[model samples]
Target: MRHHVILRVIAKLGIPFIVLFALYVQFHGDFGPGGGFQAGVIFGAAFILYALIFGLDNALKVAPMNLVITFIAVGLLVFAGVGVARQVSRLRRARRQFRRRTASRHPARRARSRDHGRRGHDRDLLHLRGPGPVAVEFLIGHYNYWIFIFLMMLGFYVVVARGNLVKKIIGLNIFQASVFLLYISIGKVLGGTAPIIIDGGGPVTYSNPLPHVLILTAIVVGVATTALGLSLVIRINEAYGTIEEDEINDMDQEP
Candidate 1:
């Protein structure tokens, strides 16, 4: 409340740190293990904490719904549109390169081109050789995978089965977190270091960085999704005076 001095004082003292930690996580991830999504969540959490202590009305005044909505749209368009544009342009470029390859009539060149194509098309996820008969020990070694799978299922169940909107949101967050865990798990190496360059370090084995980059993108998406969801919850509370899904449905069904 406006009159609650203790809360106001503490929030004043702690909010900055929350925001700072979030910033650190976001920017520092590039070198160690931080990224956009983790940053976004921390940023969002700061606001959520502010709302909890300072009141939702104050939070809205600080971060207007219109502004939030505008940013959500802007972020979605920039992220998704850029991704789509990049994909389209890359495909077109690849097509042009393929045509040039096909135009060549040399047999040796053709064979070499075919082999090159096969190698180029090969990817970590999709390989000519399959994962090839998973072993029990191999699966057991990566226990994080199992943990994420469990969290994902739990989150999915809550989101789908619960009637309480807040609980559903919690579940959605859990689901998203589990997905992050899954990505991080893939990037992790059994005995590798962070993908960082050292001045004198030689023959440094490191975890894959690709998944971290992808997770950074996913984090941005997650923040937008979470913000949108919370905004919807606020509107639902205003409209129906309750955020329970069943209650909303009953109200809608009533005369």
Candidate 2:
């Protein structure tokens, strides 16, 4: 790999753009489809390509194993910490709601609550001007949902039924992708635009951005998890001389 001068030069030129693109994805997520996971994979791939061209030792020198491991741990911790904070915030909100005076509850209060519930439901599905039963039923029975279900089940089946470690990892990725689609689907609003506030925008329905933000974190976490799983598989293969589950089991039973 190191002997290929043209390859090395091309990698040198391409790696920077790849990393820049990853950064673009990371920041552009707020405004569009790009996000953390896509960025992380792209960033990782740049270095991987560098390693393939320049040599593993050079890549390791640039990003030591210790640094990589630490970064992974830090990322996981930050993700978990955010989740814990969200849970705490929710609990506080619940307590506040519960503490409201029962005697003061009135029709207006009920109406407000009902409106909030309606908005919540709308966030999960497009709020048609007047969604009749047929429209509701049709949306619920859409082919998008069937595709999501099929991918989820197929991924689960592959993970459960496949013998190859690599196949299992691929299955897990498919399952993750299905979940991503589900969140994106539910977060979409038919007539909604971005949640950006602007002057003279009049009245606007904005799609919820929370799901997208959460998915960004989930995507990064999923990438880390996949990398760790693959590393473990590599180690397992090195130890067992094979990555097939049945072969490993047979080897274990040989003793």
Candidate 3:
């Protein structure tokens, strides 16, 4: 790689742009078609590209193992924190509303509340909300789901059937990609635009932003997984002198 001066220069020129675009995709995800996963992949690819051009040693110098691990933990904690915060807030609001409603109720209702208690009222409220029917047309709209299924199966088969470590990693990536596609497809609303509100008279439809946001986090996790897998594969090759699963197995079995 060091011998290829032109390639190194081009990589140096291009890596910054790739990283910048990844940041844009990460930030613009709510208003556009990208999110964490896509951005993470792009960012990971930039580092991977840098590693290829400049060498893994230098790449590690930039993104040390401790730094990577810390960021991975931070990203996961942030995602989990958002979910926990939302849940806690919702519960508090629901409790406040319930107290207000119960307080405002008539004598008979108050008597029932005293008898049934807070738990009973909450249980009744949950039971009151029946399951909704699924529309056939709604299911039909997800033509991309079949693609997701197909890719998932292909990736699964590769992981299960292949002996090559690299091929298995590729299959794992494909499997992750299929799941990503499935989530994206599930979040899509036909004719829906970005989930942004405009100060216009026209009623606008916005796609669900949750899926994109979730996928971004998933993407970050995926990048971490990929890096970890590659590192393990490197270690395995160095130790066993082969990356094929069967070869490693045979070597392990030998005296």
**The candidate that achieves the highest lDDT relative to the unseen native structure:** 2
**Best-first order by lDDT:** 2, 1, 3
CA-lDDT, candidates in order: 0.78, 0.79, 0.77
- In model 3, where do residues sit more than 4 Å from their true spots? 15-47, 60-142
- Name the lDDT value of residue 124 in candidate 3: 30
Q: After the best TM-score superposition of candidate 3, give how far the Cα of residue 95 lies from its true spot, in angstroms.
A: 14
What candidate 2 gets wrong by more than 4 Å, as runs, is: 1-6, 18-44, 69-141
**Candidate 1: tens digits of C-alpha lDDT, residues 1-255:** 768899889988999999999999888988774577678778988998899888999999999999999998998899899989877778767878876875753333433344345434322332234364554544665567778989999999999999999889889989998999988876665587766656576655566666777787787688778879998999999999999999999999998
Per-residue accuracy of model 2 over 13-130 as CA lDDT, tens digit each: 9999999999999999787755776788899899999888888899999999999999989998998999998777787667677658532443234333434666554344434445
The TM-scores, one per candidate, come to 0.60, 0.67, 0.61
Among these predictions, the greatest TM-score belongs to 2
- Comparing 1 and 2 by TM-score, which wins? 2
Residue 45 shift from truth in candidate 1, angstroms: 6.4
